[model samples]
Target: MKLLLVVSNYPYEGHPYSGAFNERSALALRRLGHEVEVLAPRPYVPRGLSRLASRWSSYASIPEHETRAEIAVYRPAYAQLPLLGGALWSESCAYAVSAGEIARRHRRAPYDAILSFGLIGAGGIGWRLGRRLAVPAAGWATGNDVRVAPRSSFGKAVRRSLEKIDLVFYQSAELRACGAALLNVAPDEMDARRHAVLPRGVEEPPVLSSERRHELRRAVGLGEEQVVVLYLGRIAAPKGVFELAQAMARARERCPELICWMVGAKRGFDDSAKLARCGSVRLIDACAHEQIWDYFAAADIFAFPSHGEGMPNSLLEAMSTGLPAVAYAIPPIEEIDQGSGALLRVAPGDVHGLADALVSLARTPERRAALGRNGRARVYAAFLSADRMASAARRVAQLIETRGVSFSQFADRSAAAVRR
Candidate 1:
């Protein structure tokens, strides 16, 4: 099958971590013997305005086309205003600007199906294109689109998009319910045939010997005796970086040898000054996805106090590396844990509780080892990339086969229902 994946976020030049999960899925689909291509509409900012800010500069720098993991990725430029509900209209802007190009490509060689990530943004593009091309379209609902976007100024866009796309894949069951609520429908109304969970997969890491682990720690500037707690994600407020800084300070009061390393890009929420006050926290710039395993290998524990998530790849990667996790007890996190006791859960925004959880994991070697074992087992047993992707490929095939026959009729009914 030939598939077109439309997503707003995708790894681009100098920003490899961006949209990494979406790339992984495309690669996985390709590995399943399907021809996969990506349409990632980058936010366009002119060269002069780009010079004024790093954010705009990055957008201006994106190449029109690039190949990642042997898949062709086309990045068309779209006008992206940074203010006044620009985010809510990004999908419409992208579709409006790039639809002709997409139609031209379809005329040359048609796509079998279209898959979109981020329901309100990319999903709109996919739904519009799928209708024009008369192909099956599936949308993926990640955390922000369901939880955060629905509460924003253009929140209704999410419900409208969800209603248009019949097949929606969620990162977790909790996220599915959240999306269902946004649609003003009971969770059960999101029938199994229409909605399902398709989580991101973590590749299992090779076990490191004690000597190699020590070498990795020293390479990252950590001492042999220090208990390392690593946080991997965007250094933004919603990701709980500020709370992490405070929690690290409190944890250090009890265990001075506890060292926290926060890795990844610094976003709008700059916590560098706050982290400096913490003293024991080390802030590392985002590195290639390939290099992250070294940090996972060196860490004694993984800390993810993120306020919200749709199956965090970092937490899963850390667990796959046999590292214990201490995280905020959000619904998605709890759904991932599934009562396995593989994680030490703390209340949302509770700095002291976060500190205690960190201390508890840092001081107890036995508990850490046990949790690590459980986490590793859980991830390998159920969350391997190959397994998850294989399941997703099968579902996509089913959707294409079924939806192709009745999409026009379904569209008519959906339009009538919405009008009524």
Candidate 2:
């Protein structure tokens, strides 16, 4: 099947890590023998005048089109309103700009399906574009897209788009339900027969031996007997970075050997100032995507206090590396809540509870080891690789086959969308 994938964020020349997960999904599809073309919208300014332009000028250096790992990617610059975090209307303008580009490209080689990597920004765009192309359109709801956007104007747009969209590709059942509520869809009607779950997956983790673990720790300047508790993701308020810093101070009081190492970039929230107060914490400004696992190797536990998530690549990668996770008890993380006692979860915003969980794991090596093993086993059994997500193309093809292909079905779906 041929796919025209529209994503709001994707890795560019200056930002190799912008949307690594989306890139991984594309590569996985390519590996699985599918023809995929990417239409990723980037905010940019003129190159020579970029320095004098707004904050979004950082992307000015990236070429509009490039190929990585043999996959064609089209990065079109769209007008953006700087500093308006969730400026709903800005996304519509961006979508209009990207939709024009996709339509232009469609004239040369028609695609079999259309899917958006993000729900709000790209999903709404896909809905509009799909109606024009008369093909299947689907959206993916990651953590912030559904969990955080509901009740906002963007949420309403997503809700309306959900009614029109032919399918919703989700990360978890919890997130799928959230999308249903946003769409005002009845619970019983929300099914795989309509919606599907595509949990984030990881490449098989590199083998780590006792000596390799010791070497990785020494390389990272970790001392012997010191337990490393790692947090890797965008530094955001909802991620509970500030609470994590406070929890580290409290947990260290019980297990003096415990140290918190936060490795991520300043996306929206920069808790570097708050984290400065904790002397036992270590900071590594976002490392390269290829090098993240080494930090996991140097760690004893992966303690992520994130309040909500679609399906965390960090949690999946860390678990694949055999690192036990202590995260917030959110619906999306429910599947990983393995009945085999794999994960330790605390309620969101419970700093003290996070500290206690950290302390318990730190003081008991056997318990940590057992949970880590269990977590690794669970990840392998379920989310083994991104290749699993590549099946999205097949699902889209199936939808096109079962629901719509000719003018009559397209007109029917299009009219239904108009009524919604």
> Best-fitting candidate, measured by lDDT?
1
Q: What is the lDDT of residue 179 in candidate 2?
A: 80
Each model's TM-score, in the order given?
Answer: 0.91, 0.88
Candidate 1 global TM-score = 0.91
The regions of model 2 sitting more than 4 angstroms off are 44-55, 83-91, 148-151, 267-269, 403-420
In candidate 1 the C-alpha lDDT for residue 364 amounts to: 86
Off by over 4 Å in 1: 46-52, 85-89, 148-153, 267-274, 408-420
Q: What do the candidate models score in CA lDDT, each in turn?
A: 0.81, 0.77
User: Candidate 1, residues 304-373: lDDT per residue as tens digits?
Assistant: 9998888888899899988999899998788878899877889999999999988888878999999999
Question: RMSD in angstroms, candidate 2?
Answer: 4.0
- On residues 75-154, what C-alpha lDDT tens digit does candidate 2 reach at each position? 77776545454635446776766765576567567777788887777888787778766677877877667755667777
Candidate 1, residue 219: Cα displacement in angstroms equals 3.0
